[model samples]
Target chain A: MRDLLRILSRFWRASLAAELEYRVNFVFSTLNAALGLVLGLFALSLFFQNGHAFDGWSFDASLVVYGLFTTFSGISSVLFVPNLSRVVEHVDKGTMDFVLLKPVDSQLFVSTRNFSPWGLPDIALGLGVIGYAARRLDVDPGHVPAALLAALLSLIILYSLWFALASTSIWFVKVYNATEVLRGLLDAGRLPIAAYPAGYRVFFTYVVPVAFLTSVPADVLRGADATSWLAIEVVVAVLAFGLSRAFWRLSLRSYTSASS
Target chain B: MTFLRRARAFLEVYYAYMLVYRSELLLWALAMSLPFISMGAWIKAADTGAFPLAPVEFGRYFLVVYLVRQLTVVWVVWEFEYDIVQGRLSPRLLQPADPVWHYVGGHVAERAARLPFTVVIVAFFFMLYPEAWFVPSWTETVACLALSLLAWVLRFVLQYAFAMAAFWTEKASSIEGLWQIGFLFLSGVVAPLAVFPEAVREVVLYTPFPYLIDVPVRALLGAPITLRDVLIPGAWLLVALVAQRLAWRAGLARYSSMGA
Candidate 1:
């Protein structure tokens, strides 16, 4: 664990240095993030224009969900997506051998090898939205712990889901489109799961579990009784992580060293 | 070779290239259907009389938006950004053909390759909501198809122009990202323009954004097609083509001066 921490720190430093070389990226990403938040707010206002509530979600409540979705998007883009996209490139170019030969866990190294510091603006913007929404809703301080716990579990589930998808590149070598599929699912997370039909809600909650990534956390923040949902999220996260790790091992076993 | 023969060869090459990435094309078609996400919320809101659109109308509108989006979406910004940053445009410049056609050809071919998948998805939606499906009059159908082609051309030129910023900065993709936020809301991807606040709708109707997706969708949904609808998009297409030409010339000059 100590070695892994050191490696991650070193990798992060390198990534930060590389990213800082292009300072304009920070400005552009900040602008893009702000524009995205504005659009989200616009969409929310449009939805609430005719009524006070949508499918039992007040405007402020839906904003909370949108905030959670934005935060998740930031986290994924900053950490998971950049790294997983590399997995596809490495597999395609037979550079996976170098990754495996590294003096650390291959999965760990591969998953944490890079980061996009520009994505920080997205995180900041998302937190700002969440704060504004929470204030508007007058969320109770008592709900903070559950909300934090649900948010953590949601992150875990999302990372596991991305890892599983990235691992498929070892066999398919061109499953990069998996991220696009995930993006589509994440777009759905901008609204409460209950807003969808019964069939879509079932598919999102159990099959893809995008509902758990944002809606459950938002529900907890709204002081809703989401304890059971949080429990399910935790269970799903653990199972997904274990299954993905096993799949990674199986994929690695089939990976022939390209250098040879 | 003559221009038509060269164009034919480019189309064939890109068509085969697209076929090789059929899975990615299918995934892209699926991803572009994100209108469904907002459709769910609007439908639910309509059910409670919170929105003006009937639930069935929301279904039909979003379904048409989904299909039109798949048909018209352009990804040239990413491609041009890559070529500029990696100096790949130098080789293409040496060829007899203009590189813009390479991107245009690839996009058109990819859309053709995605036809089967688009049909499958549309059929599935039709199966699920047979009552929501509507076939427009022959004139409306023909006009919608023509408008969609114009929309695609305008989008392609606009994105290619935007991507030319890569010659000046490494963050060109950020411009595309920012444009997408505006396109998402103003183009009626989130909801029909008719449902927007009357003042906002009036303003949006004058912009090029609505011509990109909303006009074609409205026409396909049996809304009255107007001469103004065709004229506005035609004007925008001419503007985009001029901008694209100017940007391309400036970008090539920069590329040459920089010895790249």
Candidate 2:
């Protein structure tokens, strides 16, 4: 595990240097991320115009959900998605064979290859949004530790979700936009999960795992009921990780390229 | 006759390509359906009185929104950016046909091929919400339909200009993300502008994003729309077109593609 951390740190440095060569892009990306936050705020404000609260949650609660989803999405995009998008390219160009031949796990290398340091702006902006939304909701600082734990779990679920979705690309070469679909599904998290019909809320929470990514963290931040779901979240995260690992290995068996 | 001949030849090639990769087109269309799902959620929310929105109104509004998105969303910018990065743009530029015309032809052809799928979605909306298809006045519906066409043209041109930034910038994906966020909030994909703050809605009225989707959707769903409403969106369409031209001209000079 320490060696893995050392390797990731080296890869991260390499990625930063490569990205820094095009510095203006960093500014544009920051601006782009800021625009996403602005849009989320605007959407929340629009929803609030219709009612003081949607379903049982106040506008502040919804914003917390949006912010949490944004934070998770931003981190996922920063750390995992860029590498995931490149999976097709590597496969098409036969560069994936190199990854398979590496001493480390091919999945690990492929999953961490394209870390973008510039996406840190999104993380900062998302956290700021979450902080502001928490303040609006009058959330207590005493709950900060729990909220952080929920947020970390949410990030794990999100990362695992991406892994599961992206692993399909190894088998289905046509699935270039699966990550976008995942992103869009995450966008569903921008709204308060409780605002959805009970059936959808249940599905999102249990089946799809969106609730863990947005609602649970938001609820924890709001001092709402989240403890009951914490154990379920952990179980789901572990299951998701196991399933994705299985899928990744299955895909590898069918991979045409060989180290030879 | 000469123009028709060229158009036919271009469309033939385009259709052939579409047939070969038809699944990709279907996937793209399916990927775009998340907004419809959000609209569905809003409709149900309205049914439960979660918001002031009437269920039928929400249905009508979102159907129009989905259709407008189909017409207005442009993929040119990202396509150019990818082509540039992959070193394919240079060869395309060397072709006898102007690259812009080729792209326009490609987009037009893709739109044509996808028409069946778009119509199926519209038909589903019609079946589910007959009230949304209600036409109080034929003249109004016709005028709105015309405006919708104009809006799509302007939207495509606007996005093409932005996409042209790939000629200079390495972060066109970030630029596209910013535009998408703007579209989500300002363009009425999240909800109708009527749901936004008066001041915010008023400011957005001046921007091109609303005309891209919201205005046309409103005009279509609220058929028998006033002459003034019809004219405002038309005027914005003209402005968008002009803005697109200026941006395109400025961007073209900076484009070096992969060779440079």
Candidate 3:
């Protein structure tokens, strides 16, 4: 564990130093994220026009969901996208041989290899929005930890799904767009599950599992009695993580490297 | 080579190349599924409350939005930057014809490949929710298709202009990211322009963004539209064409190959 931590820090620092060489990207990403937040707010406001709402979700409540989605988008760019995209490149180039040759677990190394600080602005903005929404809702301080726990579970579910998609590259070598489709579908989480129609509610909840990623966490954040939902989120996260692990192992078994 | 012959060769070769990536293209088509998800929310809102567009109309509108989005999508900035950064632009530059035509050919061919996938998804979606289906007059269909093509051209030229930044910076694609935020929100990708506040919609219509997605969607859905809808985007296209021309000349003047 300590060795992994050292390795993680080392990789992050190296990438950070290299990325700093192009400081202009930081400015561009900040601007991009800020503009994106404005657009999201505008879209949310459209749903609330004339005292209407997304199903029963007030604008403020949905903002919490949007905030979580933004926060996770930043986390995705920082962790999931950078690493998982490299997974495809490495597999395509028959470079997975080198990854397996390393002393550490290949999955760990592939999953935690690089960090992009560009998502920092998005992360900060998301937290700011979340705080603002929570204040508006007058959320109880005691339930904040419950929200955090649900969000942590949400992260686990999200990472597992992304990793599983990336791992398919070992067999298909071009599943990059599969992950793109996943990210696109996950955009549904920007609103509460209840906002969608019955069929779509089932599709997102079971097929894509988007509900646990944002809506459930938002519900918890606003102090809704959502313990049952949180429990379901816990189970879903665990199953997703385990399934991803098994899938990666199976995929690796089929991976025939050109290098060796 | 003559102009007609050169265009023929580009399209044929690139079409074959795109056909080879058929499955990849399918995944890319699926990556734009956000409209379907949003359609569910809009339909729900229309069902549960008073809204500008009816429930069936919201369904029809968002489906058309998805179709227009697929038809008008552009990724020239990323491809152009790659050519510049990797110095692959040299051989194309050495050719008698301009290199921009190469990227344009690829985009057109990719769009051709995407058409079948788009049709399949639309067919399947209508199968599941037949209530969203609508039939429009031939004139409206033709006009919508024309505007969709025009939107594609305008977006391509604008992005190609931004792609010129690769001459000075390695991260030209970041500009695409920023541009997409505006494209997603202002272009009515999130919801129909009818749902937007009248004043905001009026202001947004003045911009090129809504002309790209909303205008075509409205036209296809048999909503009231004037020649002004077509005129605004046509004017923007001319402006973008000039900008693209200036940027290409400047970028070519400053261009240096990777190992040069």
Candidate 4:
């Protein structure tokens, strides 16, 4: 694990150096991300127009979910997109064979070999929003650990879903854009899970598991008892990660390289 | 006669290619299901809140939103960026027709291929949420189709205009992504404009974003629309056309596509 961390750091540093050459792009990306966040918040505000709130959710509490969604989107951009987009290219060009022959774990190497600072603004803004909400709500600092734990579990579930879908590219190169479907669905996370109807609730929780990514974490942050959903979330994170790993290995078995 | 024949040729070849890529197109169609997801939230809101529209009306609004998105979605910027980066544009530039025609042809063809998938998804959605079922009058149907066509053209022109940024920056799609942020909020995808505050709705009407997604949606919902609604997007279409012309001239002068 230490060696993996060392190699991952080296890879990220190399890409970061390359990306830093575009200072103007970084600035534009930051401005764009900020604008996006503002507009997103504005969209959320619309639902709260006339002081109406979803059942059991105030606008302030919804902001926590919005923040988590934005943060996870940032995490996706930083890691999932940069890597998964390349997985298509690597497989398309038969470079995956070369990657597989390497000494280290191919999945870890591919997943972390590139880092994008473009999503940095999004992460910062998301954290800023989360902090802003915590301040406004005046929550006791005692709940901080619960929030952190929920955040970590949600992130794992998200990354696992992304990797699991992206790994299918080994057998179906055209499935790269399948993530776009996942992304469109993830927009549901921008709202509180309670805002959705019963059918949507069931689908979002069991089918896509979007609730675990946003609402569960936000629920914990809002001083709610985690007892109702925490165990399920833990099971989901473990099951999702395990599924992604098994799927990747299963896909690799079917991969046929052009260069070979 | 020659122009008609050439256009047909382009469309035919692209149509064949799109048929081969029908599976990929299915995923792309599924990606536009954000409206359905948002519909669930809005419909749920109507059940509890005192809002402008009823639950069934909100369902129809977002169902139409899904259709508008499917009909008007554009990816020319991504294709153009890839062509520029890979120097594939050079060979296309050597062709008699402008490269934009090829992209336009592909988009039109892909829409044809994607229609069945869109139908399937909507059918499934209706099965699940039968409250959303409704049929517009013939006049509304005809007017909505015409408005949707205009929306598609406006979006395509706008995206193609942004694609010119690839000559100046290799990643023009990210620039186009900024436009999506605007679209996500102002285009009435998240909520119907009727739900917005009177002041905000008045202001948002003037932006080009609403014409791309909202006008056609409202038209299909049998909402009262004036001649100005059509005129505004028509004006933006003219503006984008001229802008794209200028951008094409300037960008071509700067373009250095691999030994050109």
By TM-score, the better pick of 3 and 4 is 3
lDDT of 3 by residue, A111-166 (tens): 99888899999999999999999999999999999999999999999999999999
Residue B154 in candidate 3, Cα distance off native in Å: 0.6
Q: Rate the local accuracy (lDDT) of all candidates.
A: 0.85, 0.74, 0.89, 0.87
How much of the real interface does each model capture, measured as fnat? Answer: 0.69, 0.43, 0.87, 0.73
RMSD of each: 1.9, 3.0, 1.4, 1.5
Considering every candidate listed, which one attains the maximal DockQ?
3
Q: Write the per-residue lDDT of candidate 2 for residues B3-101, one digit (tens) a residue.
A: 788778788888777777776776666677666667757776677555656877887787767766776557777777787778777787677766677
Write model 4 residue lDDT over B230-252, tens digit each, in one string.
99899999999999999999999
Docking class of 3: high
lDDT of 4 by residue, A122-168 (tens): 99999999999988888779888887988899988988888888798
For candidate 1, give the DockQ.
0.68
Off by over 4 Å in 4: none
DockQ of each: 0.68, 0.50, 0.84, 0.75
Candidate 3, residue A228: Cα displacement in angstroms equals: 1.1
TM of each candidate vs. truth: 0.95, 0.90, 0.97, 0.97
Task: Please give the distance, in angstroms, between residue A219's alpha carbon in candidate 1 and its true position after superposition.
Answer: 1.8
Selected candidate, larger lDDT, 1 vs 2: 1
I-RMSD for candidate 1: 1.6
lDDT of 1 by residue, B85-203 (tens): 77788888888778888998898888889999989988998898798877788988887898899888888888888898888888788888888889988898988887788998898
